[model samples]
Target: MYKIISEETDKSGMKVLNIDKSDLIELMEDYKDRKYFLSSITGVDMKDHIDVIYHLHNFDKNDYICVKVSTTDEKVPSITKLWKAAIVDEREQYDLMGITFEGHDNLRRILLPDDWVGHPLRKDYDLNKVQYVSVDRDGNEHVSFDDKEGW
Candidate 1:
């Protein structure tokens, strides 16, 4: 019971449906019951808002579809309950794009250190201020702006 804001076919001939954030969980649950597996989850910082995209595939039918939900608050429903693969996919999106997957069991940096500052994939991420990451003897990673401490 979700409304599709818009629908279009991408260059790859895959159907893409843009929907409201509130409809994501309900729609994905239906797709899961129909045997559609999650292919990936990614986010795009649209300057004004963020677009969280979910790619689903039905192997039995050899079909692919993408569900997109736009959020200015950078938050959306987590699909990890429906698809286990979404655990890592959502984490990557959260780490890189700063999109928070609400109801996620563990939403944290997957690629970057816990102390890493700023989401690098965002449109307004500062590139001039350099950050560094280093590992200690205990194998714990640390992020720092001071070059000497990081190195």
Candidate 2:
């Protein structure tokens, strides 16, 4: 349902494609037949939107491809079904960028607690309003925020 918006080669000589999120699954399915390895998934919190980037490598061809999907709605379809390797990456992205991956199995915060309020990586995240939490060796949890500094 989507088309490639652009293509380019990075400094590492890897092929990169900026595509619509709607077309990611179909494109990935096509690459699956060629046996592309899922290298990594990264999320960028752009001011206007969030970008999810997927890196794939075809070892046989000595080639790498990166697919980028930018979404303003903060949501995208999960490709975890096609590449199980994306599980942790997807969760990390969701936790940090506040982007949701629909249909992802076990999508949850990977680096933050369940009670964490905001995505720390977001450009608009308020650091001064952050809560500080500490855990003792005895497994006691202490959560507090700086009232004077608002941090």
Candidate 3:
């Protein structure tokens, strides 16, 4: 339950939007309806969940808007309705982060295989490590990663 989206400049003097998931589509539509171009869509993981951010720019007005939607829900609503470029971005998030875009046209893995085990962008995730280990110094063992390899 985030509040209204802001269009003010931050410490860097660049306008940014602190958008909530619910208001994502509306914000995107506002820019698209004004003939803005889709700039980018990226994902950020907050340990507990993932957030997909969309950036749009209206060259004529020199204005840019950012829209963010969380992926904690069982299904995240798609913004492809407002910006077609969202399709690829959302797919990339889903593939690597396990985020699902419910209203997307083709919600499939974009970068990883369909059978990927877990979200890779999470802070707790280990890239090249897998399984448990016991340090001889303390003789205390713990399972850090799941059963994969090289852990």
Candidate 4:
């Protein structure tokens, strides 16, 4: 159900498939019988759209495939049902890249605090606008809101 907009192999000999967002789950499910393991899920902010890449590997065949889906919308389908290992990766993407996983069971911040203002990993995030917690030598906890620029 997915169209391959582009397909190429990198220098490392990995097959990269650029597919539509709607066909991600279906394409993955089709290869489920072949025991393709979910290696990782990564998100990139491309200004106009966010790119979500799913890296899969077949240990038995020593083959690898990277599926890429570009979407302007923040929400995407969660493939946690197909691969249970995606729970953490998807949640981290939601937290950092501000992408929402519609069917995710626990789509909360895996790294940042719940009260954090913005997604730090996004290109638009302003470090100077952030307020973080600090501690004093007297063992006093304090919230510091400074004009600190970039990390």
Q: Which candidate should be chosen as best, given TM-score against the real structure?
A: 1
Candidate 3 positional error at 121, Å: 1.3
Tell me each candidate's TM-score.
0.96, 0.85, 0.70, 0.85
* Clashing pairs for predicted structure model 2, backbone only: none
lDDT of candidate 4 over 1-151, digit per residue (tens)? 6578899998888889998899888888977778899999999999889999999989999888999998899778999999988999998898899999889989988776665678888998997785765555765444445534221
Give each prediction's root-mean-square deviation over alpha carbons: 1.1, 3.4, 9.2, 4.6
* Error at 102, model 4, angstroms: 1.2
Give lDDT tens digits, candidate 2, residues 58-149.
Answer: 99997889999999999999989998888998998899889899999799988886557889899999988968666667664445565343
Worst 10 residues of 1 by lDDT: 142-151
- Greater lDDT among 2 and 3 belongs to 2
Model 3 bad stretches (over 4 Å): 1-8, 129-151
Local distance difference test scores for all models: 0.92, 0.86, 0.69, 0.84
lDDT of 3 by residue, 63-91 (tens): 77666666666356777787778789888
Any idea what lDDT model 1 has? Answer: 0.92
On lDDT, the candidate that comes out on top is 1
RMSD of 2: 3.4
lDDT of 2 at 104: 94
